[model samples]
Target: MSLPKSRLLVIGCVWPEPNSSAAGSRMLQLLQFFLAENYKITFVTTSARSEFAVDLEKMNITSEVIKMNHPSFDEMLKRISPDLVLFDRFMTEEQFGWRVDEICPEAVKILDTEDLHFLRKTRIEAFKKNIPAEEIYFDADITKREIASIYRCDLSLIISEVEMKLLQKEFNIPQNLLHYLPFLLEPISEEEKLSLPAFKNRKDFISIGNFLHEPNWNAVLYLKEKIWPLIRQELPDAKLNIYGSYPSQKIWNLHNEKEGFIVQGRAENAEIVMKNAKVCLAPIQFGAGLKGKLIQAMQCGTPSITTAIGAEGIAGALDWNGFITNQPKDFAQKAVQLYSEENLWENSAENGFRIINSRFNKEAFQHKLSERLLNLIQNIATYRQKNFIGKMLQHHQHRSTYFMAKFIEEKEKR
Candidate 1:
């Protein structure tokens, strides 16, 4: 006898726009993982669609528009009755997890953390306050909520190994509860590398990220105020191309053609832009998880000059693609050196290929994740039994959050 086909309901915070941001790309990658496994997916989101949002229908994936604190979601969830419910982020889980738990107790709950929200929040706080890394603790309110959400779910997907270690060591989150799933990608072929613009041919330095993210915006400002002046001094003609989605008026205000600082909002083709660039610059002061822009730069055969924080997790026991420095002066100098030296650029690009092949081989990651899900499905009851704390948190949060949602629903009706 054959096993029955599995159904998955993915509640997204927003519709995916893979071209717009790394988070969007990450979401599509996850969806593709399930689709490849022959899992029937129904992607439902409460957020309105963006112009850049990928059309799920084109991929033959069913999608629905959902509402928060509404009874309608329960009915819809009940009708589909997915074997697995994957929350896009902790926020999405907080919104609809209780309803799913109540409606279908047997459905396995999975939280795709994208990146640890609490970790990112803490890093942002530390960066602003100039607090020592050692002083940073789990005192923030987001920490409580995010950790609780982690426990509430049967399994949580951690995208970075650093984050997985942090949760296990600092927070004492059980290893069984979390699984590390980095960006799943195939190794680049020799032909693909040859097709990329050669080091000598590529010109100018580029930086790309979603401007809506605080860290990305901060990095851009750091480049303009401190880092860029030194780099501009070295390469007067070279431009720093700033590309991202939803650039606010303030973002555009910084654009100055005289200074060789260009804020080109929303690249129509992010990869193409990266391909043509000699070097990528992301002087990230604070953030968590692997930096997607840096990864993209590597794939495009473009070396990057980023801070230690920017290069974190992605470069494990290997030489960085270009250079990693915390100082603004050193970062600028490295960017200049990498831009001019073809041999150094090629060596760095080779290191990037090594990291991708060993760390993020798509097939190996997919197989491991599939096995994990299968085991959980078979032994969900026993798994839940081991996670007594998860049950306690779930029991309490469900009761409290349930009433809060009810109050909102009642008010909205009135």
Candidate 2:
């Protein structure tokens, strides 16, 4: 017998690997949220993985592997007949949006845009050298595809409020189509804070991020080239350990155990390393959404010093757990000051805990999120009626993306 329509099909670009990337962590959290709301989740992915996959069996969630750039996914999706289909990112939607529209028209489609790819790319370009006016105005091909994917979906879960505003003020996307949702997290308990390794116990400076991301790789390069030299001149004994997953031979060559620069690849437990470290340095010149490393640092009671771009739209009105600086010399100086001063480090760390509790608490946002989802589902017809622009965009996408995907599918068969 066909199950009653209470299933959510989350089509991921890849399987969830909470330890490997922030995108993975966000996917797991969304699964948990729906689970709490009493919905069965079917997670579908195309990317193969060996290391660091979320245990779906443990969560009682069913997992399925779908073929990429193929029509087999349509058959798999049709068999499930989900009430709601959530696309993990814009690319996933671009690949499967038309198929979902055809196979499960009644299913409410949702796009979870892990982060705005165009924003990240634009920022990276600007940070590279002098940002040009034409560069900002330059047509980003990804934005068109992403925005079109959003139009095809019933709603999009936007991680960054800044992105939400940009979509509204700049692109003029209707408010009904976009919903702001950050990383929903449990507030750190007072007892948990007390149990964490204190500032005095933890020693040395650390910069940790996933190596797959270019921004992180660039940040590490910045530290090695510009920042570390200045920092070492002041604190000669201070050691800087770079921790991340997937360190290429290029990254490995930077390891100087003698000079107190160690490139430790793929930390078994990020929290363990974070807790043991006195300070986290994320001189990320450019990126979108929140930085998971910064959040983890806060969770582990380790203060961080990041760039203005690194700290973007994360803490809201709350004071940062550490300083934000762009200048290499100032950043290095602050690193020494934050590392040496116990009172400063403690205060900053406490501030981080407060930011997490206030900004990203799961319990705080879960009820509101559920209510929003319910509103979208219940009044979807009216919502769609009001969103004439989305309807027009969707109509055009059906003509454009539909034919494009069909062409690709046909070419693949040959």
Candidate 3:
């Protein structure tokens, strides 16, 4: 029997901006997956339009502008009455989740947590002081809020398996409530990969990520303060090209031609930059979730040397495409070695191709995800009944959010 096609409503924390963030690329992947499955998608965001926002019209995706902290959202959601509603992040879930529960009671609620904000925040706090994860966990206030958001949704899409286990062991969230879905991608064919610039053709060592992310900024600092000097001492002429969007003054100030460090902000084509780079370096001290820039590096047929934390939740049991080392001296040595050895670089590049195919194939994850959605739609009552914690949170949040929204509406009228 043919299953009925679903009408999906995705409430975004902000519009997808692939050029600006990993979060943006993640949203585009989700949109493409739904489009491939022939589902109708209506993406709604309360954020005002920006130059960075993805052009939905260019991609044939429907877009809607919503008002923040207003009853108008309820009316908007009711009029659409979608079969499934996806919240882009925890904050979006917090704002619109209650309204969806009230207006479209039967609709399946999915939380696409691009990455765990709480984990990222906690890690940043610890990194700033150079403390351990255990020390950071005790004081993480955002985790409580993010966890609450997880329980309120029918299913939360997690990008990292490490995070999946963390939620299970630390937070005690039910397995049914979480879905492990990494970056959805098509496997790069040998022919396609061959078309990429060879190791000899590529030049320099490069690292790129959205600078707004603390981890990327921190990684850059680690490279400058510790790694780059060692690398330059070994390979005197080797250059390090740093590319990303929205560089601050601090990031710009790091640019020094004599030192072989260049901060090239916002790649006209991110892949083009990666394709020409000999190696990607990410000496991340601390962070959460998968690093999209690393994935992009591999996609561009460029191998990388990253820390254990930088490679977290990415490769699983598979051998990393390149070296994974945390030591300052060891990281720099590998970067120099990988850049100069064509055979070594070629093998690592091949490993990258395998990693993406095995770990992130869109068809593999999408089919599993589709089945889970079908099961939820089929036995939603039974599923919700089993999730007593979700029910409690949903029930409580519904009352609290509704009254708070009502008060705001009344005040605005006066």
Q: Give the candidate number with the greatest lDDT.
A: 1
> For candidate 2, what is the TM-score?
0.95
If scored against the real structure, what TM-score would every candidate get? Answer: 0.98, 0.95, 0.96
Residue 145, candidate 1: C-alpha displacement in angstroms:
0.7
Q: Rate the local accuracy (lDDT) of all candidates.
A: 0.90, 0.86, 0.88
In terms of lDDT, which candidate is stronger, 2 or 3? 3
Put down candidate 1 lDDT per residue, 39-102, tens digits, no spaces.
8889999988778999898887899898899999999988999999999999998889989999
Question: Where is the poorest 10-residue window by lDDT in model 3?
Answer: 1-10
Compared with the true structure, what per-residue lDDT tens digits does model 3 show for residues 21-52? 78899999988878776778898898888788
Prediction 1 TM-score vs. true: 0.98
Candidate ranking (TM-score, best to worst): 1, 3, 2
Alpha-carbon runs more than 4 Å astray in model 1? 1-5
Worst 10 residues of 2 by lDDT: 129-138
RMSD of each: 1.4, 2.5, 1.6
Where is model 2 more than 4 Å wrong at Cα? Answer: 1-5, 132-134, 411-414
Cα-based lDDT at residue 252, candidate 2: 97
Say which prediction, candidate 1 or candidate 3, comes out ahead on lDDT. Answer: 1
The clash tally of candidate 1 reads 0
